[model samples]
Target: MRDEWNAPWGSIPELVRWAAVRYADTEAVVDCGGRVRVTYAGLGARVERAAAACLAQGVRPGDRVGIWAPNSLDWITAALGAVSAGAVLVPLNTRFKGAEAADVLRRSGARLLFVTGTFLGTSYVASLRRAAGEGDAAGPLPGLPALRAAVVLSEDAPRSFLTWKDFLASGEGVAAEVVRSVRVPGTAASDIVFTSGTTGRPKGALITHAQSLRAYDTWAELAGLRRGDRYLIVNPFFHTFGYKAGVLACLTRGATMIPQPVFGAETALANVAAERVTVLPGPPTLFESLLDHPARRDHDLSSLRLVVTGAAVVPLSLVERLRADLGVETVLTAYGLSEASGFVTMCRRGDPPEVVAATSGRAIPGVEVRVVSPDGTGLPPGSPGEVLVRGFNVMRGYYEDPAATAEVLAPDGWLRTGDVGVLDAAGNLRITDRLKDMYIVGGFNAYPAEIERLLAAHPDVAEVAVVGVPDPRLGETGKAYVVRRPGSSLTADDLIAWSRREMANFKVPRWVEFVPDLPRNATGKVVKGDLREASGP
Candidate 1:
């Protein structure tokens, strides 16, 4: 284990101190909804207060605190607060139903939960209560023995749940100072980030703080993130891409962050113009939506100095359109996963247009990437193989899953990325496909196996297989082929509706086909490659 003094700013609180010293009065975070602005100093104080509150609740070092909220000021505050309190922050997807959300909360062993009362039209508190096995009329979560308390983010405080204002108010005066001094030894960059797996289970990738900060610093240095530069964050905070690239990077570099709760292309464009955002990074879908918007012509995006797209394979045409129509000088492509603390490979700022469009760029500083065959042998350039990365940015291992960790992280510390890619002579990475049946829908990982498992649970379904099909808008959408049981008459609409109820909205299959039997290979494996190809464009 690395010494705390030698560690690269071991906690988010440390990073906050750095930013506060440099840009104390600058607007650190801006929410356009209520036009709420939090200056660096003010943000630091709130973080300290929240941290104190966590400590008051007996949250010690390495304790898991679940953050089940949407993209908001409170979400960021709670995340930083947990880190400051020396607790491992576990961010839950807001789209999850009660059962799904509870599973993550229970599995993570979260002692406290911070959730919004409501987001958009969804009631998060209601969902969480139901998931906790406390039905609508029930008081507190029934089975969450580990959960000490629930803090609701609302103007009006609930009877059973503690309100955000009251929670923050609990950490006043000298208590905040004591919380600030409480430091843990092992709170390095290598912590766990629970990402959804193809098998419907969430795997906690152990990414170190060093790896995360390296990604932030590398991108900041390469992208020229100067002080006073504003960034527009529309990407959800749960994903590593958004957390590391969007939030941490900005916080580390003294850049202002303008967060949008939900993504609306027109609203994003307006915010960009309003905030004079200099650096913007999101999935290609966001940019595509912006380009397709009729109002884009009227919006002024000239302030954007750098535009980055990653998480999914970016279309070359989209790259061309941004440069041609939007006048974006620096268009970059990045490639990484939850295990690598966001991005390990990214195109440099001044690279030639073709190179930027074709590759995931060179490995960032201190990171080593190699393309290797299935037998663990190194492959020559241009030969596609599993991309293995070993670096400061590589995760320590999966949390508490030694067998799963050993399978991916070799004896030599190389982390098998499970992504099929080829390294060019210049070491640029071009991804082919994922080794696991994982597909990206609008930059979010949608595991076909997970969706298939959910679809099979439907009463009318006998068996089902889900595969990714080409989608112009989302990049890829799930298409399921089902074999109904004897005497069962289930239509595609029925399966779709069932999926919408059983799983998150994004995991629902866009198209469903009834087939007598699924094509299988000689080895008795369902041939998804054939299904995807046969589905057609």
Candidate 2:
């Protein structure tokens, strides 16, 4: 058999096929939520069945199939199955409320949706029904005319939805050979990951199958992932890093996947000890929580060996603590965004402690990284400027949004990352600031404009400006300065409580200050730099 790195599979389907035969008996995924374990062979069969089911639902190639749920065994099967059947995967954020998810679904024109029953006390199906209201025509959710079916990944479902068992059984009629006949090419768009940029509206970045395979294959090799190494993936699958680095990387390396739907420090410790989880990738807050948890000494976490963290600032102290306290063999930091296929500069395995803690390492092979000034001139080493990347892994473009795509992608093929950074003498990339007012909240990207737009929906909120404030535990959290409407007796606590219901938990501001008016410039644009300074720690 060809080595995963030397002769990588072209498409996800080809990779799945190869791994199923090569690692048939190897433990593939361990879903703690349902206490299920499947081998690579089992996963492959399940994916084929899932593909057949999609075909049974009349899903055609290039059709958009969206999965709006948390991490689980069923999620993998369905997502991979949809892709194997020639559909472009669209993973919605599990943290999204009903309205937030519907907006993306409408924009993408998704045909089939696989939604969870109820997650974290809220019934997703009910929330979706409320958000969609009554449709003027047919389909599971009338508000989404393009959506042909909605499958609930649970035993029971609402009136018009299909249960997990029923959905799988529908495809039993199709022969396996028929499913194998449809081979997806490497150039076909694999997934469209939607990210909120400066516009505050989420745009889908179209990434091809080749880009996904090549990037994560490199990610697996760089991280030293190998056969039998169990990985505990806490990152949400909706994001590119979570799906590409967590799932796809494991497949290439024959590693076992342990999906954590939600992150709780205690639960994670238990899983690490119980499952002998060797690889753990998440935001720095996750490590901080594990390190500080009072019950740390109670668990047998000796099996924990590798950790990969980034997105926000990485402190030297945190790096030392992981190696010293937990006896973790390797702890590395890296940086990437959805636009770059979530694979960029990452510290090598044997790098010194100082380098790993300080900078996101040199660019990956076949990719070029350059820092440039506002005048489009290349900046010298140590000068912080806009980071530009020209890479095979860079996304094709935003799906069908040519004007928006043209803004960031230059004609010369250099992708303007909009992130301010400096390249040291050794080419290590250290991100200093953002051209766009975006922040990282426990690994989730939080854009100020997106938060402002959501906050504006409040009836009493006259105006609001959000800035990222440092949190010791969470890398950074949002703090909002608001101007309440006249005669509105809106309290900070009141707005905070209301925000919990309206937006994702990470996007919700941790602190709210009432202001007379927002600080604005001559052009009337909100001067967020001033707000960020005023909200300083």
Candidate 3:
């Protein structure tokens, strides 16, 4: 029998081609800055040009190509093009510093990098150059020996980088036939997304084209996404939520994608009024800001039809406010991770505010979810335990790290999702907490281990342990329990300032406590429980 859950498109390139042919004149994407717009046909052509450019740059099948840029029209074209040309796309978080991004490129062995020249008043190319150092005029840069080229996406490229226009221009020498013939199998790795590991680094999760298409097809349906819907995507593109759920979902349904590089209440409200955006999805903090904005009622927001929020607890009042105040018809909450292709469960449209706010809803079709005990047995209903997932949506494996992959992905295809949740009798999942020590700062994952590593680099920080503490605005923010070195008079403010420059904004600690020593247990591990209690209200 034929599979009912199989996606109509076999691969990412195939999906774009199908959309171009089916909706040639339909607007596919619009830059929120009013800089560029493209129809389905136009997007298809640009993607092919990008693919041809990759071919010209010698990107081979199975090779990794990295994009270290924020949400932009070129980000979409470059990422799709790289994957279309049979190279695995590695999306580096735009919030990362040069050192952080270089770590991913080095680990992924990416040979080419597409970076933004300037964004949010910082020159990323310059930061990268500094990170690479001026080498001894010969030996490889610190950790990026595999990266051979840097293409800057900007009006004026830096002296050391290739301009976006020039990068595309290089494709002129490569024939269209050659680009079209470079096809990756549906099951082949399309992207290697890096998520924070407890080991003070990040692990690459290998995802396939078919997995992405199938998973988001279900996501779009449950979220009430449809043809001609104007989707204002505020989520960062490096995440699976934006790249797969936001961008690919739009492509699958013929929705017009409007990428918002920055999330601000006034800015998002302005775009909604101007673009008549029907679909808006973000973290609860986004909606809270929009609702609490001083000019909340100033804009004509009647065009909004659907609102989806997650990555933290969804306030019932927020859902009610969107419907009562903003006149939004549907507001939903979802639960997923990068390992699950960014899709697992979603609160269906029209679900009651209580259910929508309280639970993560049931698993999508073709995916099985269970709450298992520590010994690997299924837990009874209403009992919270580790959530385990088994389905096509699960990632192939942690890229090139079988040992790490084995810890999570079982031999029988079940994935050990390090999240604690209870499955009600109705199959709805109410997320209680996390099995892993990860905190959500405005929908961004701030792994304690990752933050601790960066803090340990501080000159005055002799010892440090990071933990998540409650925050009214960001759901949870990091609090660093630090022990200063002898004779070192480093203040909490000093470490906070240092963190701002050393790591991503979300991962930076919001609070710091200077203690003489860390409380430890018999096992010699720092007692995080004591730290959390000490960081009390």
Candidate 4:
């Protein structure tokens, strides 16, 4: 018999429209700052206005619009606005530097950018200016020649860029009321999420609206989301877990979202009780911190009915503590990547505590997962191999990078997740390690190649290699082994300081070791595995 839950949903916009009608008077989005709340009607109105503003800025169908901002009501508004304007939304990590941000903007050919003035202690306007300056110098940003304007989310805009209010004013009042004349459906490349590649560069994984919607639809079912349920969103909106699982799921299910710009353990716990948040999903680190917070016992988190965690390997002890202390009955463990548009495997709400705590759970209905050996042969149960995924939720491909796309997407449409895992006889997936030289620190994927590339760019560094070292707080932190140029005396502190200025905080190597030469194999390739072992516990 066919599963009733596996039925296909047509499009994403349908869900948006559904929420507009069903929860018109319900509080849809609540910004913690000043307790700003937007009803479904207000959200729909703002999305249309933002869409019209984007169109006024010359964004046409299929044009990419980059959103480099943190978690906020406006960030979600701009995303829906871009979609309504028939533009593909490109969400850039707010932690990215000007150069890294420029690479994605240039590659996506984003004509317009929507960014916040200040987010998580960084000035986006300043970063945009830095990126724009690179464009003036005929750099990578020049590839996005269509990029002429930036819309900043602030009352007082930057010197040259347009303010969010002013941009909305430019659109005709009725323009926001306009609805799509065409019925779009199922995997039409709605957004592009950039994931760090093993080759040091980033890959823009093109996810259609349908794929994202499918993720939310399936996840909502798994999590038991429903109308009036409130969700505390601490995950960054730029990540798929936040956008698809947290925001979109809430929107589609007529649930309310309590938006938190930054993740602080105390703030999250307080918000959960204050907002009556029923659903909470974040990285394991987030939950651990909240559980370990000195003031956790003082807060009333009893309202939390469900908590989902992913993006890193969660220790079983942490899972047990969540259930014992936090009273979270439906604790789920899920696994997915940007390429899968969020979740391919997940533990259902009613799953046994041990199943939820110890395993990544079964594949979501409609998603097929396989464990394959190096020779492309399928591995049996309990055999570890590179995890391959095929599903409706799989990304279309890397935007404008066919060669790179081909390397990951097999002709049969399976996406090589580069994650090493084994499937038990019960079909639960257990991730062992990454096949690619990438490490997860606090849920952020950091590629050794990327850090090594940045380190090699330093004038004092002749050769460099990076490996992950175990860390109690971050799970895994980068440890760099560098060979300085002859007569160049750079201390470990110097390298750490330099990295802080050059890369994102999470990507920076926590410890730097100076060495004459890196361990190499017979073929002269740096043995990163050996380095990891040498830097062991």
Model 3: how far is 227 from its true place, Å?
A: 1.0
TM-score per prediction, in order, is 0.95, 0.97, 0.97, 0.95
Q: Where does model 1 exceed 4 Å of error?
A: 1-8, 135-139, 157-159, 185-191
Q: lDDT per model, in order?
A: 0.80, 0.91, 0.88, 0.82
Candidate 2 per-residue lDDT, tens place, 173-290, comes to 9898988898799999999999988989899999999989988888888889999999998888888767889999999989999999999999999999889999999888899999
How far residue 344's Cα lies from its native spot in candidate 2, in Å, is 1.0
Which candidate has the highest lDDT of all? Answer: 2
226-267: candidate 4 lDDT, tens digit per residue: 998998888888888888888888887889988788888888
TM-score of 2: 0.97
- On residues 1-537, what C-alpha lDDT tens digit does candidate 3 reach at each position? 113676657989888889888879999999957668899999999999999998898889989999998888889999999988999999999899988988898899998889988888888877887787643323234447787667889878755467899999988888878988877788999899999777767999999988988888888888878999999989999998888889899998999999998888899999999899999999999999999999978899999999988889887888889999999999888899899998888887768899999998888888889999999899999998999999989999998899999999999999998999999888989888777788899989989988998899988999999999999888899999999988999998899999999998999999999988999999999888799888843
* Displacement of the residue 103 alpha carbon in candidate 1, Å: 1.0
Question: Which tens-of-lDDT digit does each residue in 1-537 have in candidate 1?
Answer: 111124346556778767776779998999855379999888888788889888877788788888877777788888888878888878877667777788877887788889888786878877776667552233357667678777887776455677888887766643756886976544353246777555656788876555566677777777777778888888888777667787888887788888787889989988987878887888889999999999998888888877888777777888888888888778998888888787788888788877877888988877899999989899999999999998777777777788888878888879988889999999999999888878888777888887887788888889899888889899889999999999998998888887777777888889999999999999998988889888843
- Score candidate 2 by lDDT: 0.91
Q: Residue 46 of model 4: what lDDT?
A: 82
lDDT of 4 at 144: 55
Of 3 and 4, the candidate ranking higher by lDDT: 3
* Per-structure clash totals for the candidates: 7, 0, 0, 0
Candidate numbers, best lDDT first, in rank order: 2, 3, 4, 1
